[model samples]
Target: MISIKRFSELSYKEAVVLWNEGFKYYFSNMTMTVDAFIRKLANEGLSPEHSVVAYVDHVAVGFAINGFREMDGKKIAWNGGTGIKPEFRGQGIGKVLIEACLDVYREQGVDLALLEAVAQNERAIALYKKMGYEVFEELVFLQQNGAMTIDAFHTNSNFEIVRGIPEDIQLLEFFQPIKAWQVQVPGCKGAESIIVKKGNEVLAYAVYQRMMDEKHNIQTIALNQCEIKESIDVQKVADFILYHVFQPHHKIKRMVRNLSKNNRLVYNTLLAAGFETLVEQVHMSNRLDQPIKESIQ
Candidate 1:
């Protein structure tokens, strides 16, 4: 028999053990030390009480990491991750965990639940679909190593680009909130934003983070979000945004986090810059408009 327990009941060390076990065969290296695990919870606003772990015969064999945030007056829950030990696969434990997570979401008054899964993970995708989650878009982490050769975005007296905080992007006339969970302001720790304006009208904006070296020189640059008005030349604005966020002068590693493939201009721009797709996932979301008690009970 299987049993589910709130992660709050387990020690961080146990969380690490269960986490490592849950993601043992994941697409990427998800191994976590106790310190890193704690940091993730803190940085991502995940709570032990809101997450769940599975056990069989008192041995933890599965887990789900969930997080909550309020956006646009609606409560949103993110399924940060979910995994089951290889030995425990093919059973109905995963389904039970989903039901438990739904319970958490309902209790927390979540308006919507979102998650991402590796595109190649058919079983997981199918399971999520069965649970009423719909695949909305493809998201990819694009990467480029070594020096960047970015094209300059020319500007006359009418154009100016300036540095700003992540919140500034929201002030733009046509800013769209980033749909990816980790890149949003709440989850994007140490991130900064930039805005380009033609006279007093904003044309484009971007949010990025730089990882510094011991000497404070640029070691890596990461672009999290970029948006341009509908009327602007997307390719040109995208190139310009990359030029600003990536900074062609530095010989450093660079990346774009979980960008939606549907955003053709930005996604294609990254590809044109030789940024290879490092990771690809299917973004899924489930509306929480109905009551969960009937289905869950």
Candidate 2:
């Protein structure tokens, strides 16, 4: 009575309903309207044709959103999200969905498949391990609200911040291989970008996206990437970016995602500047050395 099919086969309403039901009682609220769901799919590069939906007796019971990007000349795939309806948990449905995703990655000639799971989600992490994923990095999410008072400016510093597009920001040397998949150039596409420069030399860069409510009021400011040049104090550069990024909007919620543990300066600085740790996640990856065939249960 169980089967899996391409997500493209379902209507947007069906997919969003399944998404909300699957994420019921999740760590964070994931409720989404049809319009929000469409925006997320387009922003995250998730495609219905590349994603999968699970069915039990012909009703949607679970779903996965997948995306593909070329990185460093290799095709990389990401499991943007995987969800199973609350009632379907512990039924081994997650395993089936993951296997389906890997099969799709292999078929697409992806050299790597990546995903992140909430650190507290032990069961999901264990399942990913069983599926050949290895924890390569630990990531942190930070957020702040109300008023940000930290001085993001330095009188001794001669850096000038320049606003640019994501493409221009990504070309900076600070954007390196260590970034998480969701913060990479592909993920930052269509986002606002800023770069700090001292004359012709680039010191750091940041990329963030703004989401507005129906009233056109800024609701959230999500920082996707922040890269500081080597040999410079990371915290200082981060402060500079934060000060300018949030100064114009005092009432909006500010957030930064996927700061790797290996990069502690920026991470620690954010916390010191009043941002609280929202959650931590483990970044896991599975390398596809050979083709894998889908075996739906």
Candidate 3:
């Protein structure tokens, strides 16, 4: 008999074993430790209550982690990760895990669910489509290395940049130039946020986490809201920081960032900067039409 259990019910070792086993099959050379998995869950805001493990006759056969938060007053959930043991393929375990996630979201009053499936994962994409999910956007993961030039407009001596504190960092939000999602670096607690100041006004900012990966992933870069409309000179700023700050400590093999289909700034900038598109993913979302509403007196 197949059954589902919350992630907290399993020991750390069990979760790691299950995760690593599935990852190795789906992704090449992917290895993760128990401590690393636990830390990722915590840092990415994944809770035990949001994860489910599938058990077949008391053996863990599959698992899924769903991370959620309220964005713009709407409950949104992301499928952080999900996998099934190799031996358990074609047994409908994957479908079961997805349903379990939906049930959990329903209980949490989530109006929308989101996940990114690699473009090559045809089976997973078809499964999501069958479950009433629709592809809303295509996200391209790109990477590049070596030093580049900084734009003179941003390099003006009057602008000031400061590293971020934990409290001040929380004010940052995703969907900006630098997404908040990239803050999930392995050991990074708080990221360094650079703010551009002209006189007493804050004009733009970029936040990034130093990645633990050998490539030194510069996780995120968000320009200030006002700078979005102006000629922010992202490439110049990125090139400057990449060469001066990150390149010294690391060889800068590659830096990866995701860009949505509609995001012209980063997508175009990355292309011009010679960051090759390594992979493409479809961003899927499911929303129940005519959501049931409850009235509060």
Candidate 4:
């Protein structure tokens, strides 16, 4: 027989074990220390109260972490992470974990829920589809080795660059539409924004998060009120950012902006900047036509 328990009921060691098991299943060489996992959970607000652990005969076999936040005035929930022990496969544990997460969302007044699964994870994808989840976007995870130089690109007479600050949170709030998931990471600091200003007008802006790995992650970028006259040329901007921000490091890896299937300009920009897709994940959501309006911009 199987039982589901709140994450709070388990000790920290048990939670870490479940987390490591799930990560290793997807990435064979993954070895996240307990400290790192704990930090991530705390950062993402994945406490035992919001998470679920499954056990069989008093042994933990699977677990799921969930998080919720307000976006665009609507409550949103995310399946932060989940995994089942290898020996417990084909026993419907994944389904149970997912259902438990959805139940939490429903009780929390979350109108929408979201998750990402590797594109090749057919079993998980099928299960999600069967549970009323639909594909909203496809995310490409890209990475690169060594340092690269960014070049300054000349654009036609239209926009100028302006530095942004946290005070511009209201303006940045405009980006809730294209963001994948929303959560606050207070310890994850050092965010900078650059606006493409047309004289006194602010057209588009990009927000980047500085990572400890000496790489800058493009958390979100958006153009508002007006469409970009010319493609903002992502390659030049990325190169410029890296050259100005990243120093010589053993390796540099950052998560780039999310791209829709039809967005070719940004795609080409990442590719031109030497970012090769390491993996592809399918973004599944329970809300199809919901409005999102928080800007990481």
Query: Which predicted model would earn the best lDDT?
Result: 1
Could you report the Cα RMSD, in angstroms, for every candidate shown? 3.9, 4.8, 6.0, 5.5
Best by TM-score: 1
Q: What is the TM-score of each candidate against the true structure?
A: 0.93, 0.87, 0.74, 0.77
Candidate 1: which stretches are off by over 4 Å?
150-158, 290-297
Count backbone overlaps in model 4.
6
lDDT of 2 by residue, 131-225 (tens): 99989889999888865663533224546978988778646665665357678777676688889877788888878888889998878888887
Worst 10 residues of 1 by lDDT: 150-159
lDDT ranking from best to worst? 1, 2, 3, 4
- Runs off by more than 4 Å, candidate 2: 150-155, 210-220, 232-235, 248-252, 290-297
Instruction: For candidate 3, give the lDDT of residue 219.
Output: 40
| Candidate 1: tens digits of C-alpha lDDT, residues 132-180 | 8989889999888886553433312335788978887766667665378
Better structure of 1 and 4 per TM-score: 1
Model 4 has an lDDT value of 0.61
TM-score of 4: 0.77
Ranked by lDDT, the better of candidates 2 and 3 is 2
The lDDT, on a scale of 0 to 1, for candidate 1 is 0.82
RMSD of 2: 4.8
> Which candidate model has the greater TM-score, 3 or 4?
4
Candidate rank order under TM-score: 1, 2, 4, 3
Give the per-residue lDDT of model 3 (tens digit) for 1-297: 789999888788987888887676784455689889878887777877778999999988888888877654667677888888888888998899999999998888887777888888899999989887888777776666554334312333334555564334345442242232433222135555555444554444444445554565554332221122234655454434333233433334445444565656545655665667877887787784246232100
Candidate 3 shows a clash count of 3
